[model samples]
Target: MHKKVKVKPNSKQQKIEEQPDGSLTVHLKSPPVDGKANEELIKLLSDKFDVPKSYIRIKSGLSSRQKLVEIDKEG
Candidate 1:
């Protein structure tokens, strides 16, 4: 199954969680600009799950705090 996450950029502590509505909540230290936050998110998630960066994708909310990301099952 895929996880839906809320992206929180520029956070003091980085974390990720599954919300009640089946969404993910992430705390990131990267700023939400120039795709930095998104890049960090992908990198973090990929490492967390032991997957390659190319296996993770931002399905939606690219420019917002709430993001829908798709993690490759085989990744």
Candidate 2:
């Protein structure tokens, strides 16, 4: 399933919190600029969901605090 994530980067540790509106709060140490934070978020989600990294895609919010990701998996 696809999920909407709000990214809070440059933190001390990485964390993921799922909200009631089907969104997520992702925290990572990588800075938000230069795509570092986005990369970290994708990696974390891929590992957390046990899905391939290729299956995780940031569909929106590249330059914003909020993001939309599409998780497409095939079995």
Candidate achieving the largest lDDT? 2
RMSD of each: 1.6, 1.2
Can you write out model 2's per-residue Cα lDDT over 13-56, one digit (the tens) per residue?
Answer: 99999899889999999998888888899899998899999999
Which window of 10 residues has the lowest lDDT sum in candidate 1? 1-10
Model 1's C-alpha root-mean-square deviation from the true structure amounts to: 1.6
Residue-level lDDT tens digits of model 1 in 4-68? 77888889988877678877788999999899999989988898888889989888888988767
Q: Which parts of model 2 are misplaced by more than 4 Å? A: none
Q: Least lDDT summed over 10 consecutive residues: which range in candidate 2? A: 66-75
TM-score of 2: 0.92
lDDT of 1: 0.84
Q: Model 2: clashing residue pairs? A: none
